[model samples]
Structures are given as structure tokens and as C-alpha cells.
Target: MIQVLRPARFTELTGEDEDIPRPPLSQTRTAQQSRRRKQKKQLERRWRHSAVVAALTPAQAAAVATTHADATSALDLLTFLSRERSHEYSPDTFATLALRLVEARRCPADVGRARVHMIRACRTPLEMTRAMDDLDTLARRGPRMDLMAYGALLVQLNTLGMIDVTRARQLRQASTVHPPILVFLATGLVGSQVRWGSGAPLPQGIDLFFLSHPILSTLASSDRLLPRSPAHARHLFDGMPRRKKRQSAPPVSIADRIGTLPDSLLHHVLSFLPVQAVVRTCVLARRWRHLWRSTTSLRIVGLDDNYYVDVEELRKFVDHFLILRERTDLDLVEIKFNEFCEEDQPYVKTWVRFALMCKVRRLTFHVRGSQYLYLDPHLVSRHLRTLDLDGVGLPETFLDFGSCPVLEDLKISHCIINACRILSHSLKHLSIYCCHNEFNCRIHVSTPCLVSLKLDHFIGRTPLLENMALLESADVYLSDYCKDVCLNYDSGVLCGSNNNACQNCVPIEDDCSRECVLLGGISNAKYLKLLPGSKTFVFTRDLKHCPTFIKLKTLLLNEYWCEAPDLDPLACILKNSPVLEKLTLQLFSEGPNHKVEIKGRYSSMERPSAISEHLNIVEVKCSVVDERILKVLKFLSALNICFIF
Candidate 1:
């Protein structure tokens, strides 16, 4: 409550006393009215103080301290409480108010008024010392002075230096608290100590000490007793820029820090590190020993030292890790094992089943061995989105991913395709690389949603394709070895003398049937990259039954062998693809003697009358284009197509 000050008692309001002379009778009436007004205002302030004290709960005060834009008001409230209701505020309460006030700029009057409250908040010496220490630490870390103040200090130093017209002008500037000036002073002191020593003569009745030492001394004095050192001079060097090295922070265990975080957050952090590193965290402290069981993502890569060194140990660890996972849902489960023992097969199957049981979304396996690893069909999960299998063959029935509904991307590399059919409804991307077709393997696929398909170094009878209406792009490369059977065929003069042997010769119907099925499936592809590995068989094998690529826009022919007959397949593809826009010929030949001759645009058959309006760009990637290649270029130029070689 605000105490009304009497005329003679100044301390009642302002905390001071002053005597006032009494007014005459004429002024007495006005003085009486003024005293009554003061009393009424004091009474109103007392009631308001009571109401404010009742409303200002601890939570409300903290809220105001955090959200209030006017910090001066908060400081004033605390100051008023300190004066009227001093017992209500604790050390923590005042400390919080003081911090808020320090964080924002307050008026000089408000700061002075709050100073008393801040003092009262820390009633004990220890509390005040702790508060001061915290403030000092904050000040050391925060900016010593703002840019504006720094600029003003520089200006002051410049003005002071102008008074001295000697080299000592810099020394005069160094006496200021400017950081650069202080650095210069410290450097000068070091140099002085290195150059001068005790051999130097000493002056009478004068004392000196090293600037680095916290010692006080006088330059010279002849007073009755001993001379006193100047306080200002002693403090002048206190602003040296050399910061005292801070003590190293105390050692903190990883488990202690991790234990402080929520279990979910700790699991997420562990997920990014390798499984080995995650397991190693158990040694940090007792709290982290069981934390690995909470991780949701598991990536077991066998190529690393932590994985395949001991297959048995790795198997046991994985089994334990999976069994301990309390959560039912997992984000990713990846297992990449280059090689493992036959005896470890059961453990691998168990690991996969466990992952399926947990409803893992993405699964990958790279386990390789002599025989194909048979996976249980019942272990499939519908939540799977991506399934990548490398160096691991699949069973004939496992190719169809009906059990995995949401599977969108599939990859098979260096594996045997014993399956007769590969079908999926939700698949968008499919890649098969270096895959061998088993004996009697009749590969087929009917993925209507497939958008991108890549086939490289594929060996086998062509897979039957159906319902691939949405197929947009395809990269097909038949291996050179696959065409060895077709190359051995004797077409013109086939051993007429040995008529009986001629009957046993290879039949073309089987090869043509495979080509027909494969080409029919990818007929709607918009972009096709056909890398032919054989010079003659590729054209003779498939060109007869090649389907129309009405939507074909881009065609790439990677010709590694520049044989004269290699152009036949490319010519067939170009003639059939009417809408093809960009033609790229990737040529790689070692011999300069090799040359290609294109007598005409294509075979002697009459050229199609329909001019390809979209066929505008022709690109040839080869170092040397001989006369034969020039003839082909000239023919393309006649059609007004641009050539970029």
C-alpha cells in the first residue's frame, strides 16, 4: 500500500525526511484540500494493491514474465509488492522478475525502483552471490557491448589520442577498454618481459611488477611512509583482451544424456546409426542396455565387419534383437548378406517371418548361395511397398506378388528365375539384371500399372507379357551369349548331302514364339533403349514379328560392335517406329579398318510412304564416321532431320 506522506514526513512515501514551513490562514484552506485529496488517492492505491496481490498467483506471475511486452510494468509490480507485502515474494520469484527486467530495456526510474525489490528478493548473502555469479556468466558469454556503444567508445578514444602528438598516442588509446587496444597492450607487455630483466637499474623509492601478475605497485613516491599505488592504473590493465582459459566441462556419460530424452526420440536417434553402433551403446550405462529393443528400423548389412565376420553370432544377435522389439509395427527391415552357410537357412527364414509378423513396410535381401533360398509363401505381408532381392533366386509361385498388395517397386539381380510368371497390380517400377532363366522357365508378366521397366543382360526365352497398357519406358538388352544358338543356323545351303541331319537342325518356331511374346508386351512403350549384343541374329530373330510402337518417342541403340550387319536391327526399329523423335546411336569400335555400308535407308523392301514428322533429331556417339556411315547420314539429311555427332 502507498503511504501518504505528511508535510513534515518525507520518508513516508519517498523514504526520506524533510521539514516544511506552515502556510498562512489564507493558504491553509487550500493546503487542507490538498491533504484530503492525497489521503483519498492513498486509500484507493491501498485497495488496488490488495486486489493485485490476490490476483498475482505464481502461475500468473510466470505468464506475465514470459508474455508481457512491457517489462517495466512487471518490475514495478514486484517493487510495489516488496514495499507493501515483502513476505509474499521468494528468492526465486524475485530472481525471475530480475531476469525479465534485465532481458528488456527499462526506463531509468523503473530500474532504480526495482533495484530495492531485487535486493530484497535475495535475503541471504549466498542467494545474492549465486544470482551475481549467474549474471556474470551470462555477461561473459553475451556481447560485451553493442555495436553502437563500441562505435562511441572508438570515437572517445580517437578524441583522447588527438591530445597527444607522439607515438604514446597509441598507448593513450590502449588505456581504454577497447578490445583491440587491450590486445595491443598485452602483446607489448609480453615483448617487454622478453627484452628487459633484473639486470636493469632500479629507480629510488619506486616499485614495479610484471603487468600479467595481479600485483599493485607505485611508479615513484617520497611520502613519509610508503607510496600507495594508483587504483585507476591498477584497473587500467584489468580490461586486457586475453581471456582466462575456462575449465573443461565435467565428463558426461552418453547413457546419462540419452536417458534424459523420451524413449521414442532415443529410438529414432539410434535408428540412424549402424546396428553395431546401436548395440555398443549398451555398454555406456545401465539405462541404455535395453534401449535398442525400442528401435523401429533395423538394417542388417552383412558386408561390414560387424556383420559377416561370424555368421552364427550375427544370426543369434539378429534373432535376439527382433525378439526383444516390443513394438508391433516397423518402418524398414533390410538384410544384405553376401554369403552364409547352408545351416543358417532356418535362421534367415525365421528373421524374415519375424519381420513380416511386425508388419514391416520395406524389405530387402541380398543373401547369396549355390541354391535358391526358398521363402515361405505364408510369410508375406500386405504392407510391403518395396521388395529388392539380389543374388537370391525365387520359387516359381513367389513371382506373383498378390499377397503384397501395395508393392510398387521390385528389383531382381543375378538371380535364377524359376518362376513361370511375374505379375503384380500395384507395381510401377520393375528391374531385372543379369538374371538366368531355368530350364523350361516360361517367364510371363501382367503388370498393368508398370511405368518403368529395365532388362539388362537377360538370358532365357522371352517372357510372355500381358495387360501392360500403361508401360511408358523400357530398357532391353539381350546378352551376346543368348544368340549363339541362332548364329549356328545354316540358312542357305544347309547340308543337303546329309538330309537326315538337316531334319534334326534347330527349329525357328520356338525362338520366334519367345520373341513374339516379349515384343507384344512392350509394344506400347513410349521410350525404348534396345542394346543388341549380336550383329545378325537380333534383326533376323525378332524383326519379322516386331510389333508397331505407335507411341515410341526416343530410341537408343548401343552398338558395341561396328560390324557391317549391325545396322540391320537399328534400321528395322527406325522403320517401324513412326513417331520416334530422338535417335541415339552409342557406338564403340576399336579397329579403324571396320566400316558400315548402308546401300539404302533399309532393306530392299519399298520404303514406307508416310514421312516421319516427329523424327527430327539424330545423334551419333562415335569418334570416326566412315564413308558408309556418311551415306546413312546423307539419307537422314534428305529428310530434313538434324544430326548431332
Candidate 2:
């Protein structure tokens, strides 16, 4: 015992002292270890329990968990168990999870994850059907279900290629759901199959199944659902009451249903029909007698061979429409009168006066027959925002647009305007087409708010822009008489032809000779157009009087003679336009053989060295490319320029 225990191998230490002391375990430590093991086992069991419960009936627990704390704890337990173990969950449970996830605040990410899980869980058609049925149930329970979820389930069914249409019809019949939702589901299913290019034929007896659903039956009765055949139509109507059966019958003619619709829908439907059909419908019933008068739009054409409306009858129709229009407070009106006679001028004036009094927003007066149109200045509507007149003769004083203060758009086509003076402050858009008279064609526009102006004339002087501070766009196609028309600016005169040439040309006092003086040039316009004609305009140093057009971006020189004289006038413009971005020159090289030579008399005049820096792009459209034109290209290219033909 006194000797220390010698360190020895087991074989060598046979029968040696085995006297090693062992420490006893502490009670507190053993108790703590036992408690921790018990806690871990309990946690694991609770997690497994939650997973099984969630897999079986997620919706039941979801309905119970109203508080945020309860929902979060339940979700956390479910998530832990799902990650720890893989298990088969019921389709109803998955659907419930999808619904709960969607309803959670700020849970789009969770909802997306749940949707993927649910979609993956749908291995069989029955599972998919059950999921859809659960969603349908939830939709009926006052909870707002997502339309896209229904769409997804339908897509799954479609992918299977052969859906149990009978079962679907049965579910549709049993469920208390909206018809639109059911239609959406059905159409979505059909559409998805169509997308996959599948030949999945619709099931038989589907009609009978649909007929069992009240909503489907109602929709079928209303003719919203497709009828399989004429016989199907009869079958769909057979079960309806007599009153509903009569209501479901198709209308024989447009007149038959005109009075049945509410006024708003009736007017909308009538708006699509032609004026003759509208008139015929009006004669169908007493309810439709004054309905046309309340229409915001009206069109009457002489093409109808059956109706022979004389000037008096036309006047009476307009009077009746206007009287009813006043009673109903209609805003928009369009009248196309094909019957025009000298006797109808007073009647026309009366109608125009009534329209003005009613403050019609849109008024279109298209006179077909030959007649002298007299528009009294006092009768012109102040509230007329748009005025379009075509195919009539207007008085020389007709274009005195002083009364139309609120006029925003004005279009006159194939009509005569004796004096083209526009003095409206609110005039924004103006267009004149195919007017072949220039007796007093002096345009005096004082609109500070003018935005767009188009003038297409065969005989007239180019109108002057006296006060166009807000003028943004202008297109002018001048006739021979407008060759030397002058444009007066606040700063200087923009003469189209040489001022000295005007002295040699006949004076303005001579009616016939006054047309010879050509005036050109528009200053400070954003868009400018120069059209081709039988007019020779020379641009000398006086051409510098043209406006600088600091904001000019688009310039079009259309159908111009290719002579050097015409090109010389344009040089001054090209030099002055510093901010010009797009320049389009269209030349009519081949025309009536009025051989004119462009000697470039102003060739000796120095070209602006800074022009190449200012102009960015130039486009020339000509019938033939010649050497002189090549020289122009060379000149532009010499300045490191790019040209397009």
C-alpha cells in the first residue's frame, strides 16, 4: 500500500492494486440535464403534432388564429415541421395555407412560396379538384379569394387535356358563386388547352350540367351563353316563364328594340347606325319620335333613294331636332344637309342660330347641292369649339371669325370665303382646303393662342401672321396669285419675291395684275412649308427680312421648281435658321415645260460660313438627280455634312 501504483500495461499489471477513486454525480447537475432532455423531447413532439394538424386541416386552425401572435406562432411551428420532415399534405390544407398566406399583411413572399408548394402538391386530378372546390368555398364565405388562383387551377386541369366536365358542371351547379367567376373559370380552362395546342374535346352533357346552374340558366336565357344550335336556342327558352320568354326573343329590326333600351344605351347603339336607319327607326314607335333629337350626333345624306326631303322638309326636321335638343340640353350636334337651295339660306341661318343659342360644342354643316350660303355673324355660336363646313358657297364676309371666341378648331373645305380674316384669340387649329377664289383673300390672324394653321388654296395670296406669338405650326400651299404675297412681321417685312421686282410687277390696284407679285417667307415659325406652283419668286437681299425662326425645327419645301432662282430664295432661309433640325426639300424637276434657269444670281453673295454648324440634317426628294443638285450636295458635304435623297 505504501508503494505508489506503478504505471504498467494490463498484461504486466496482473493482480496489481486497483485502487482508483471515482467522483460522485451532483444532484443539481443531473436534474438540470434531465430537464433539458425533457424540454427538447417535448418541443420535437409539439412540432410533429403541429405539422400533422396543419397538413390535415390548415383552414380550421387559420380560422381560430385571429391575433397576430397566434398566427405567427402557428406559422412558425408549421414551417419548422415542414423543413424538418417531408410529408403528404391534403389538397384542402394546401388551399387553406394559400388563402391564409394571401390574407396575411405584407406576406406576398410567403403567399408566393405557398402557391408553389400547393401547385407542386397537386399530383392528381382529384387533388386539383379538391383545391379548387376549397377555394370556391372560401370565395363564398365572405373572404375575397384571388381570381388568379382560380385561373391557375383551371390551367392545371387544362394541362391534363381531359377534364371531368360533368364534375365541374356539378360543382358549378352546387356552389353559390357569381356567374362571371364561373365563366372565367370555364373560359380559362378552354383557353389554356388552346394555348398548349391540345385536342381536348369538350365533354358531352355539359349543356345539361350548365342548365342546372341558376346563373348559367339566367345567362343562357339572356343569350349571353353560346347556343349549340337553333334547336338549342328553343330548348334554352322552353323553361322560361311566358313573360321572360317574350323578353328573350330576338329583335326583328332596329326599330323593334329602340324603345326597349334605356335612353343612354339606346343613343349609344343608335350612334353606330346610318342616318337613314335612324330615321326608319324613328318611325317605328312613338317613343322613338323625339329620341333622335336628343342624340349628340346627327347625319343626313341624300343617298337614300326612298326619302325625298325638300328644302322645307329639311328645315322642319332641323327645327324639330333643335327644339328637342334644347329641351334635353344636348351638347354635341352634327347636321349634313344634302338638299341645298337658295330658299333654304334663311332656314339654314335659323338652324345655325338655334345651335348657337344651345351652345353646341361640335357643329358640322355639309351642304351637298348648289346653294349660296349666308352665315350671319350674330348667328355663329360662341361656344362652338369645332366647326367643319364643306361643299357650299360662303359670303365674302363669311370668314369674319370675330364672334367665335371659344373656337378651337375650324375646317372649311370646298367652300368660298370672301374675306379670310381670322381674329379669334382662342383659335388653336385652322384648315382651309380647295378654295379657288382670291377676290379678298387677306388673312389677318390676331390669335395669340394659335397652334396649327393649314391653307390649301388654288387662287389666293399667302396670308400674313400679324400677331402669332404662340404660333407653333403652319403649312401653306400657295397658288399663282400668292407667289408674291407679303408676310408682315412686327420687326420687318418677309417678302417672297424681290421688293424691286414688285415695283416692276403690276401694282396691287390692278385686279388682274396684282396676282403676279409673289410673296414668300414665314419668320419665327416652328414648322414651315413652301409648295410648288406656276409662280416665280426671287429672293434678293430683302429676303433677309424673313423671321429668324429661332425655335424652327421642321421646314418642308414641297414641289418646288428646281431653277437656281427658287434655290436662291431658300439659301437666305437656310442661312438664317440657326436651330433648324430637319429640312425637307421636294423638287418637281419634270413639269409643264416652262423652262426656267437657276443662274444663281446670288451666287456671288457670300455663303454663311456658320451654316454648316447650325444645320444638322438635310433631305432632298427629286424625280431626277442632276449635276447642279450634286453640286449642292458637294457644298453640304464640304462642310462635313450628311445628305439623304
The local lDDT score (0 to 100) that residue 436 gets in candidate 2 is 46
TM-score of each candidate structure, all chains considered together: 0.52, 0.49
- Model 1 over residues 493-534: C-alpha lDDT tens digits? 223224343332233464334355556767899988776564
- Tens digit of per-residue lDDT, candidate 2, span 520-615: 223546887757453423223234355466778878774442344335456666677777777766655443332332211111124445452545
Give me the runs in candidate 1 sitting further than 4 Å from their true place: 1-269, 282-291, 303-310, 368-372, 377-379, 483-485, 489-515, 535-539, 560-568, 589-611, 642-645
Kindly provide the TM-score of model 2 when superposed on the true structure, using C-alpha atoms: 0.49
Each candidate's lDDT (Cα)?
A: 0.56, 0.53
Show the lowest summed lDDT stretch of 10 residues, model 2: 9-18
By TM-score, the best candidate is 1
